[model samples]
Target: MDDTQTMHAMGIDDAYHVEQVLARGPRGVTELVTIDGVGPFVRKKIPTVLAQRGVWSALGGSTCPRLPRVEATYELPDCVAVVLDYIPGLTLEQAVAERGRLQQNEAVSLAQQICEAVQELHRLGILHRDLTPANIIVADDGAHIIDLGIARPFTNTANRNRDTTALGTYGFASPEQYGFAPTDVRSDIFSLGRILGFMLTGIYPDDASYATLLADDPNITPRLRAVVERASAFEPSARYQSVQQFAQALTAPSDPVDPVVPAPVSMLGASNGGIRTRAIIIAAIAGIVIVALVAAMTLIPRWVANGDAEGTAANGTSQNAGPQPNTSPDDNDDDMVPSPDSSTQDSEDDDATRGDAAYDNPLELVETGWSADESGLVHYAFGLRNTSDSVCIQFPSVEITGRSEDGSVLFSHTQALMVAFPGETTYFGSQAGNSNGTVPATVDFTILEPEDYNYVNSGESASFKVDNLNAAPDGYGGEIFSGDIFVTKDSERVREQSSQLNVSLVLRDDAGAIIYGYTTFVDWPPEGGSRPFSMDVFDPPAYDSFEVYAQPW
Candidate 1:
């Protein structure tokens, strides 16, 4: 296909002056072009049959530094032209071929940058279905991501289907990219792992001459190899759930249980002697909780009947109590309980809240931060890790205060926390409306030992399964979703109340901040079956991703 003829047919010659022909072949025309005032961009004239290049318009003026901003896109009779800001750098493929293999630290550095760029793509609801060394440009700052020719919008579904075309570079592509399953963030992570390996070895993982991990690979670091192995796990669930997580694993310090063994910076550090240590600690915690819970259960009935217990949880108080407030808000946790990973280390791989004021305190504030919506309703979401060996902070309340530059309080309120079991972590979230559309300069958290908030050290059942989730834009431009919920297991409860299901949703923006929160209810399904649920969030804000939580009230 001649580039001049294609431009002439579309009348693009009138608006875009073709300065140079960059490449023209079966892949169609890609050229450097200039406009009346603006100049120098790579315009890709892709045939409609190849891709609906009009989708590139969404990337115009991309805020991500690693992405070549799409300046404009045009739809022609038989082709769509995408004009992107020209990035001046060698593609990683060219660099590797010209200069040989990259250093280990250099490879890790570039991988981190690529990870960040992919994270931005994910935030934009786009998946770079094909992330290869040839598509990444090695610039001064780091790597720049290009060629969204095979990108697709992110759609999370438990019943995911295969990619129709299965398009990707053989060596760098994830198995799912070859139609094994729908590619998501993990697919990009997989390619990243392959790129790291390629950069160090000068050969793809699929190459016939590829080096055996240990035998021929002496240049790769111990911990980095472990990171790559997990990042390139055959199972998507086994890989890092998000790029942020992958980066953490890459940068976190490694410890060897024994000098001869390499430690994996995993969610539970499940490697070498660490897994055994983790398992033993977990077992000890579980056994202690079970014994204490059994004792509490046996005595509760008799105590209630004989009036030997506190009159009501509302009148109870913690020994760490402050001046009791005359009245306290009802425990909002009854509305939504966060069931994060069972591991106390946190699924986010957050451990900063430990080892300082952590072990000494029963309830350690794992992480605290705040975000706001377009309307400026400040929302605070924080994680609380219960370090206690035999206690569950039932309805633990916290005083949240937003402050300004001078430390003047802007808004103050209390939110009840959920049940963080012994050595387990729970989360709390709350929102406050601001009159002037101004967010807080900073947010602070304070534990409140209110007289009324429930504090139970007893055990209860906590089993739930929410899957096959699907989201769609309501014709009116709002977001709606549906999914299935199952009561995988039941817990023993007191005779005073019946178990009820409460479903909570946390819609997050690209930065992983909560933009919206909503709660709903669903009926229990028949024994061994699941119940379907549909929910609509009113005044729903725009979000790229979301997390769901289900629990009993």
Candidate 2:
């Protein structure tokens, strides 16, 4: 194929011609080329040395939207090359270098979108072995997850069980990815979290060791820090179960409060006058409670504005105060957001009045599949019912969080919705318009972190009304749809059971070939309960299909 000057042996079509080299990597070089009628294109040629690496199949099944569109595949005598759509965007590495660290909100948004893209791939049973900033592209409109040459599908084969020669960018690879065991979705989450840490602090945590990063970044909020710390956990199981969970944890709102306790005169070692000490103690306690309440009021507004589910209301407004800051120099402040532990306080209050209420409600949820158009956006819908008459469901909010396979939170948002009456269902979906504001459907969140890729979250959900005419087929050969949902409740009754709902429609042709399909997930009952569930749809081919297979990374 290399010897042919025009239209070579790899079955080179006249439609495309090589232009120039864009970037070179260990596996191959990506080239800028022109398709006869299709404008700019990218052609990636796998080197002879890496020809045996089954990347073609990996790219085919990958759901990463940021990845270059796979136009066609070719098998050359000496090498293999795949043609793809040329994307116009800058590498994330460049964006960070130029802009320094991104603003917290911007970073979170970008990370969340990336996570959703990755989640799409993971849901299809694929994994991107190599994940790094250099492989990610950030466009003016949104970020793109590129470079899947080392990706592989999760099949029940020996290859999926064994470790490979550690293949990926060093700083971005998880410890377990280095031949410790076969890499899983969580492995990607670990790498994604590391990338996020680098994006936020400009320091690679895995390279310097997470402990070092924690010791150095004093400004890092505790909640954010906790996310990094958890993502960087040595053991894969210790990390988040999914990328959505990680994103939710990272984006969950927080408020600052003081930590001080008054000591009685007797406890203070017999002061000169017990009366004076008592007065001082009483004043201190009063001051602390009043100050805490005041801080709670100020912080709650910002927290709610950011769309976090943790904020609560007392009387009529949000009264939940965030965690107290640790004053120690070694404490990483950014990682220090209020823990979910505080949410129990509200539950305790609810438990006290359980018997007096007219009825008790067990949390339940229902969800529908997601749909998407040609532009590759996703949409989802869900139905929720307040089953109990006793518990006056006040401010109940739903949060949808996405995670990478490695359990890093990519994106999360607490959507506001009109309250649902008992036994009533509400419908919602992705925001209106495309990236250019043309299409009426678009995924609600954008993932900025690496872990945001290839993950899902529960609690928040999307609502939808059935459309029999638009329904698609289900299974492996069917088409798919995608979108999001918005859920909300008042702050008073926040802790409730969460639910996961899957929506899928199947289509079949006259020959019984799965023509089109749609599938998505929504977790409602929004808060606590139930283990994570996976969403998958597959159909076997009628005949032995000549499919591409790759060595697992």
Candidate 3:
């Protein structure tokens, strides 16, 4: 559709003109439009039927300040177009890409804004099925959530019906969006957690990348990890029940008070205005808290308990202390636990030349390489192999020292430590500008000891079996493994409607050495039934065999 022609046809007020194209995508086109005597606005052509144009117009500016206000709606022949307040700013995605990662307090503060906006929408019975970073704009005023392409009203239960088509971004989408279940506020919470993780780590929250966060980052606090882990749990029941509750927890994890519920006022029978003011004051202070204490009670205990045991085993002299204050507020920290694959490695992958404890250190320097970017900035990358019996290994830091031709110090660069998986090599590097004309002749690189690591260990449970497993070559020289995990319901019937199920896949080389693998939490396979799963192992070695393990979380 011609934007200028469309606005001319509308004949809005005394004057109206198309300003510029804001964005164009699968949904439709968004343009900046200006109407004389009415100021500037944004117009979006929504192609999807479930778009919340009218709802947005009704709610308008009456709701949360972070939400865009709809000025008008037009039903075009080919699309439904809506005019909204033009929020000029960068998106959260753009901000992260430009700034690398957000500060801890900034992330939390922005998250609270997002939570408030989402909470208001939920209160009005609206569900924004797609709440990705691209849909959020970081304006000068605050973080504004935009795009309602797939938004559905609470009364429209058909929109909640299960479908095979995925409705959100791969890394941020909740499992239910992939037809596992219905989408709800919890799904948004899941995306919020993923966003929080990205803001903290500067990494997308994909299964593999997320494992790195759980495996290595010491800057991430235990409390924050607990919140993110539960929010992004495979099952909706495992996430924060509401955005408000999640916000409350983010605002104050130590507080026991519930932020969503309003305390009863002794002057409830007083004037309406007075009661409204009282409620506002309460809401302002109550802050936020979401979900039941059950998830925290269940997940945290196991994380702490298992992490304690694994820390002792991974670092013999490591202290297994209670959760401590985070050193880097922007980074996330969690206690590492021993995974199930750890045991399998010990029993099957032992080498004749090396004793069982040979892989205890698990830190092996792989290779270091450097390249220059378009701006002549030299980027240095170093790879490390984790030969640990455990599935995951952590590194505290990496330092590169350069010396001049005379053997004098030239420059030094230190990169933060990272997490790597068994059979998989992880890389960390830094970029430096060589404008000083002092290129070093000799350079020494060192891998420092990791602060802590949790061996992700799980035992073979009699309750579940991995069947119909198949491995094939991916087009990109990688291997793709697919299989089904089934639970054999017996005396240990999961009477509850919800349960935490964790699954892992391990591949071994010809010498029985671990090479590639993946671990993920999934919704409980149907009672006495199975759920399909798949994983792509990039640049894997020729495998002699593989192993799959499942356990109820």
Candidate 4:
């Protein structure tokens, strides 16, 4: 309808002038109107029949602070028009696009605010069946929830016999809403968690289906993940018992209760203002307490886990903390216990030429090129040539270690193949049966310092075995192994070529904290005309200093 026609139909005369259309939904349209009687107002147009059912009046008196204030409601010949205060802000969806994934702090803040709004609406016996990114607007001041056209009230008698159409966006709606059952505050909480998940990970959970999101990227804090999983439970009885409980779950830092599945909370006790009012007041206070707890829990974990490097750095207290004992490497060897195999003799023969096939002294070892099949699992080939004919070299079995970028150990395993020979090459790879146990391909091999290696026979070829190979995605975001392979002829020490190679490792546990790092260097035995080569591991936020280490090879 035209601006003049709508204004006249509502009996506002020339005093009300329509400016522009603001938003359009399934049940109604909202317009920005400038009235001479009132400066500016949002005019929402709904069907007269629907307004007569008292849905609009109930929603108009709701305590949801985020919803626009209703100024007036008038009936026209075929439709009903209600005037409301204009809310100015950008939608949450827009903010997400501009700022990739929000930090944990920002996400929790927004979620708590949304929960408070939901709690208020529920206290007033109203349900905002539609709660999605589009319905939530964010301003510099605060966030506002809008669009209550499909909102139903607890006291509506017609709602008892009404076959309301399923309402809500695909990804945001609770399962019960889709089943044509009564929606409660818990349903909104489920949508809130989905929104929080989207804010943390750039991807939305809805695009891939709720089942897929839960399986692949439940991108949230562990505690929050548990709550969201429960909120989105398929059964209604499995959901939060009340809006207060849902709000508590959203605002609570710890574990939360699941919703009811078989049947939602009955509305029998809702008429008594004393009981409902006390419940609402109690919920509000509980919400505040929970918000405080959530904030503390979210922020405290990060602070306590990060050590006191700040003060240490300021005091100039020797940047090198010295090598702390990493039980990780030794622990990884234990994980390499090979399964009983009938081809143990063949495996021994393969290791015979390489070296002594024992699991001791992994430092003296060498490996050839690595390869991976179509399945993306890697295999390393080691060629150990024994220079001494008199001494029978005993090769040690290989072991793989997994660590995060921050030096936190995740997994370690041992390979069964052993080598026993003066000079030979052997092949080793992730165990065939252990394919399903593969970690993310992005881990790193921790290169031992120069002191860690033992030189033999005039340093002809000092062997340095990598006892652990951490897997990684592309070997990025962590340490890459590179070191020198030096040889000496006499005490005069005529330096030969310096060998340097890069080895990539994977990182697991995206949420784990990083602790230590080191790097390797090339261009050994520097001459007057030779260029300098170097590598260093650095701490993040500010990677000013890094530990320098020498390789065994």
| TM-score winner | 3
lDDT of 4 by residue, 1-553 (tens): 6777676665663357888876543245578898875657888776554453455676677656676777777766556788877777787878887886676678767877777777777776777766777778887767788667666776544533111233455456664443223566666766776777766665555343444444443355666666666666654466666656655776586645543344433221222111123332222221111111111111111111222434322211112212222222432222122223321433323321222132222232343222222222222222233323322322133344434346654434333221222333322222110122233233332322111111111222222233322221211122222333332211111121112211212111112212222122232333223223322111111122222222211
Q: Which of the two, 1 or 3, has more TM-score?
A: 3
Question: Model 4's lDDT to the true fold?
Answer: 0.42
- What's the residue-level lDDT of 320 in candidate 2? 13
**TM per model?**
0.43, 0.42, 0.45, 0.42
The 10-residue segment with the lowest total lDDT in model 3: 287-296
Worst lDDT 10-window in candidate 4 = 294-303
RMSD of 1: 24.2
- Candidate 3 lDDT over residue span 133-228, tens digit each: 778999998799987766666654363333223356546766565333467788788888888888877777643456676444566777777667
Give the better candidate number (2 or 3) by lDDT.
3
Measured by TM-score, how close is model 2 to the native structure? 0.42
Best by lDDT: 1
The per-residue C-alpha lDDT of model 1 at residue 238 equals 68
Angstrom error of the Cα, residue 54, model 3: value is: 5.1
Stretches of candidate 4 exceeding 4 Å from the true structure: 1-9, 37-39, 62-64, 155-163, 209-219, 256-553
Clashes of each: 0, 91, 22, 54
Error of 1 at 202 (Å): 2.0
Tens-place lDDT per residue, model 2, 1-553, is 3466424544464456767877553345678888765668888777454553445655566546665667777766545778787678888878887877666667778788778767777776777766778778888778888777667777563533324333455456665443334677877888778777777775544333445555454546666766766765645666666777766666876412222232232211211211123322332222111111111111111101221232111111111111222221232313112233322323433232212211223223443222222221122333333433322232223343433345654333443222333333333332111211121222222111111111111122223332222212332232123233323332212212112232333322232222222233333323323222222222211111111101000
